[model samples]
Target: MVLVEDALLLAASAFIVTSFVGLFRVVRGPTMPDRVIAINVVGSNVVIVIALLAAAVGEPGALDIALVYALLNFLLSVAISKFTVERGGVL
Candidate 1:
Protein backbone atom coordinates (compact mmCIF):
# COMPACT_ATOMS: atom_id res chain seq x y z
CA MET A 1 0.00 0.00 0.00
CA VAL A 2 2.82 2.33 0.85
CA LEU A 3 4.47 1.61 -2.44
CA VAL A 4 1.24 2.32 -4.27
CA GLU A 5 0.86 5.62 -2.49
CA ASP A 6 4.40 6.57 -3.32
CA ALA A 7 3.85 5.67 -6.93
CA LEU A 8 0.75 7.83 -7.03
CA LEU A 9 2.71 10.74 -5.60
CA LEU A 10 5.44 10.27 -8.18
CA ALA A 11 2.91 10.04 -10.98
CA ALA A 12 1.20 13.20 -9.83
CA SER A 13 4.53 15.01 -9.68
CA ALA A 14 5.43 13.80 -13.14
CA PHE A 15 2.11 15.03 -14.52
CA ILE A 16 2.61 18.48 -12.97
CA VAL A 17 6.14 18.74 -14.33
CA THR A 18 5.06 17.84 -17.84
CA SER A 19 2.17 20.28 -17.64
CA PHE A 20 4.76 23.06 -17.50
CA VAL A 21 5.72 22.25 -21.06
CA GLY A 22 2.23 23.37 -22.07
CA LEU A 23 3.16 26.82 -20.76
CA PHE A 24 5.20 27.42 -23.88
CA ARG A 25 2.10 27.06 -25.99
CA VAL A 26 0.11 29.26 -23.66
CA VAL A 27 2.74 31.95 -23.79
CA ARG A 28 3.75 31.80 -27.46
CA GLY A 29 1.05 29.90 -29.29
CA PRO A 30 0.73 30.82 -32.96
CA THR A 31 -3.01 31.27 -32.59
CA MET A 32 -5.65 31.95 -29.97
CA PRO A 33 -7.18 28.49 -30.13
CA ASP A 34 -3.79 26.94 -29.57
CA ARG A 35 -3.33 28.99 -26.43
CA VAL A 36 -6.80 28.13 -25.19
CA ILE A 37 -6.17 24.45 -25.68
CA ALA A 38 -2.89 24.68 -23.82
CA ILE A 39 -4.49 26.46 -20.91
CA ASN A 40 -7.25 23.84 -20.77
CA VAL A 41 -4.71 21.08 -20.76
CA VAL A 42 -2.86 22.69 -17.86
CA GLY A 43 -6.09 23.13 -15.94
CA SER A 44 -7.11 19.52 -16.44
CA ASN A 45 -3.67 18.32 -15.44
CA VAL A 46 -3.86 20.37 -12.26
CA VAL A 47 -7.16 18.73 -11.37
CA ILE A 48 -5.65 15.32 -11.88
CA VAL A 49 -2.72 16.17 -9.66
CA ILE A 50 -4.99 17.51 -6.96
CA ALA A 51 -7.12 14.37 -7.01
CA LEU A 52 -4.06 12.19 -6.83
CA LEU A 53 -2.68 14.13 -3.92
CA ALA A 54 -6.00 13.86 -2.15
CA ALA A 55 -5.96 10.12 -2.53
CA ALA A 56 -2.38 9.85 -1.37
CA VAL A 57 -3.08 11.94 1.66
CA GLY A 58 -6.45 10.35 2.45
CA GLU A 59 -8.14 13.72 2.47
CA PRO A 60 -11.73 13.87 1.24
CA GLY A 61 -11.71 17.63 1.36
CA ALA A 62 -8.90 17.75 -1.14
CA LEU A 63 -10.94 15.71 -3.54
CA ASP A 64 -13.85 18.09 -3.11
CA ILE A 65 -11.59 21.00 -3.86
CA ALA A 66 -10.27 19.22 -6.91
CA LEU A 67 -13.80 18.65 -8.16
CA VAL A 68 -14.66 22.29 -7.72
CA TYR A 69 -11.53 23.30 -9.50
CA ALA A 70 -12.35 21.00 -12.36
CA LEU A 71 -15.82 22.48 -12.66
CA LEU A 72 -14.44 26.00 -12.69
CA ASN A 73 -11.83 25.12 -15.25
CA PHE A 74 -14.38 23.58 -17.55
CA LEU A 75 -16.76 26.51 -17.25
CA LEU A 76 -13.99 29.00 -17.82
CA SER A 77 -12.77 27.16 -20.87
CA VAL A 78 -16.22 27.17 -22.36
CA ALA A 79 -16.72 30.82 -21.55
CA ILE A 80 -13.44 31.76 -23.13
CA SER A 81 -14.16 29.79 -26.25
CA LYS A 82 -17.55 31.40 -26.57
CA PHE A 83 -16.11 34.84 -26.01
CA THR A 84 -13.39 34.21 -28.55
CA VAL A 85 -15.88 33.08 -31.14
CA GLU A 86 -18.34 35.87 -30.49
CA ARG A 87 -15.73 38.62 -30.37
CA GLY A 88 -13.38 37.34 -33.06
CA GLY A 89 -10.83 36.44 -30.47
CA VAL A 90 -10.68 39.89 -28.94
CA LEU A 91 -11.37 38.81 -25.37
Candidate 2:
Protein backbone atom coordinates (compact mmCIF):
# COMPACT_ATOMS: atom_id res chain seq x y z
CA MET A 1 0.00 0.00 0.00
CA VAL A 2 3.01 2.27 0.13
CA LEU A 3 2.77 2.94 -3.58
CA VAL A 4 -0.86 3.86 -3.25
CA GLU A 5 -0.03 6.18 -0.41
CA ASP A 6 2.69 7.83 -2.47
CA ALA A 7 0.34 8.32 -5.38
CA LEU A 8 -2.31 9.83 -3.16
CA LEU A 9 0.27 12.11 -1.62
CA LEU A 10 1.29 13.26 -5.07
CA ALA A 11 -2.32 13.92 -5.97
CA ALA A 12 -2.77 15.91 -2.79
CA SER A 13 0.27 18.01 -3.63
CA ALA A 14 -1.10 18.79 -7.08
CA PHE A 15 -4.40 19.82 -5.59
CA ILE A 16 -2.62 22.09 -3.15
CA VAL A 17 -0.77 23.73 -6.01
CA THR A 18 -4.01 24.38 -7.82
CA SER A 19 -5.54 25.77 -4.66
CA PHE A 20 -2.69 28.19 -4.22
CA VAL A 21 -2.98 29.28 -7.82
CA GLY A 22 -6.64 29.94 -7.33
CA LEU A 23 -5.89 31.93 -4.18
CA PHE A 24 -3.34 34.03 -6.00
CA ARG A 25 -5.75 34.73 -8.79
CA VAL A 26 -8.39 35.75 -6.31
CA VAL A 27 -5.99 38.09 -4.61
CA ARG A 28 -4.92 39.69 -7.87
CA GLY A 29 -8.24 39.58 -9.69
CA PRO A 30 -9.41 42.70 -11.51
CA THR A 31 -13.07 42.28 -10.63
CA MET A 32 -15.18 41.16 -7.69
CA PRO A 33 -16.85 38.36 -9.60
CA ASP A 34 -13.52 37.05 -10.76
CA ARG A 35 -12.36 36.84 -7.18
CA VAL A 36 -15.57 35.13 -6.15
CA ILE A 37 -15.17 32.57 -8.89
CA ALA A 38 -11.64 31.86 -7.77
CA ILE A 39 -12.84 31.43 -4.22
CA ASN A 40 -15.44 28.92 -5.40
CA VAL A 41 -12.83 26.99 -7.33
CA VAL A 42 -10.52 26.90 -4.34
CA GLY A 43 -13.35 25.69 -2.13
CA SER A 44 -14.08 22.83 -4.50
CA ASN A 45 -10.43 21.76 -4.60
CA VAL A 46 -10.25 21.92 -0.83
CA VAL A 47 -13.27 19.63 -0.58
CA ILE A 48 -11.67 17.07 -2.87
CA VAL A 49 -8.33 17.20 -1.05
CA ILE A 50 -10.04 16.80 2.27
CA ALA A 51 -11.89 13.74 1.09
CA LEU A 52 -8.72 12.22 -0.30
CA LEU A 53 -6.86 12.83 2.94
CA ALA A 54 -9.67 11.19 4.85
CA ALA A 55 -9.30 8.09 2.69
CA ALA A 56 -5.52 8.08 2.81
CA VAL A 57 -5.29 8.42 6.57
CA GLY A 58 -8.37 6.36 7.44
CA GLU A 59 -9.69 9.22 9.48
CA PRO A 60 -13.24 8.85 10.75
CA GLY A 61 -15.64 11.75 10.01
CA ALA A 62 -13.23 13.57 7.73
CA LEU A 63 -15.53 12.94 4.83
CA ASP A 64 -18.39 14.42 6.81
CA ILE A 65 -16.44 17.61 7.37
CA ALA A 66 -15.56 17.79 3.71
CA LEU A 67 -19.19 17.41 2.79
CA VAL A 68 -20.13 20.15 5.16
CA TYR A 69 -17.48 22.41 3.70
CA ALA A 70 -18.77 21.66 0.23
CA LEU A 71 -22.26 22.58 1.25
CA LEU A 72 -21.07 25.81 2.82
CA ASN A 73 -19.22 26.70 -0.34
CA PHE A 74 -22.39 26.23 -2.36
CA LEU A 75 -24.38 28.34 0.02
CA LEU A 76 -21.77 31.06 0.03
CA SER A 77 -21.75 31.26 -3.73
CA VAL A 78 -25.50 31.45 -3.86
CA ALA A 79 -25.64 34.09 -1.20
CA ILE A 80 -22.99 36.14 -2.89
CA SER A 81 -24.80 35.92 -6.18
CA LYS A 82 -28.03 37.05 -4.61
CA PHE A 83 -26.36 39.90 -2.82
CA THR A 84 -24.67 41.06 -5.97
CA VAL A 85 -27.90 41.05 -7.94
CA GLU A 86 -29.81 42.76 -5.20
CA ARG A 87 -27.21 45.46 -4.82
CA GLY A 88 -26.66 45.88 -8.56
CA GLY A 89 -22.96 45.30 -8.04
CA VAL A 90 -20.34 42.63 -8.52
CA LEU A 91 -19.67 40.46 -5.48
The C-alpha lDDT values of all candidates are 0.91, 0.89
| CA RMSD of all predictions | 2.0, 1.6
Q: lDDT (0-100) at residue 21 of candidate 2?
A: 99
lDDT of 2 by residue, 7-65 (tens): 87789889999999999998998887887799999999999899888878889699999
Cα TM-score per model: 0.92, 0.91
Question: Weakest 10 consecutive residues, lDDT, candidate 2?
Answer: 82-91
Cand. 1 TM to true fold: 0.92
lDDT of 2: 0.89
The sequence of per-residue lDDT tens digits that candidate 1 reaches over residues 6-85 is 99999999989879988888999988999899999999999999999988988879998999999999998999899899
Task: Give the winner by TM-score.
Answer: 1
Model 1: clashing residue pairs? Answer: none
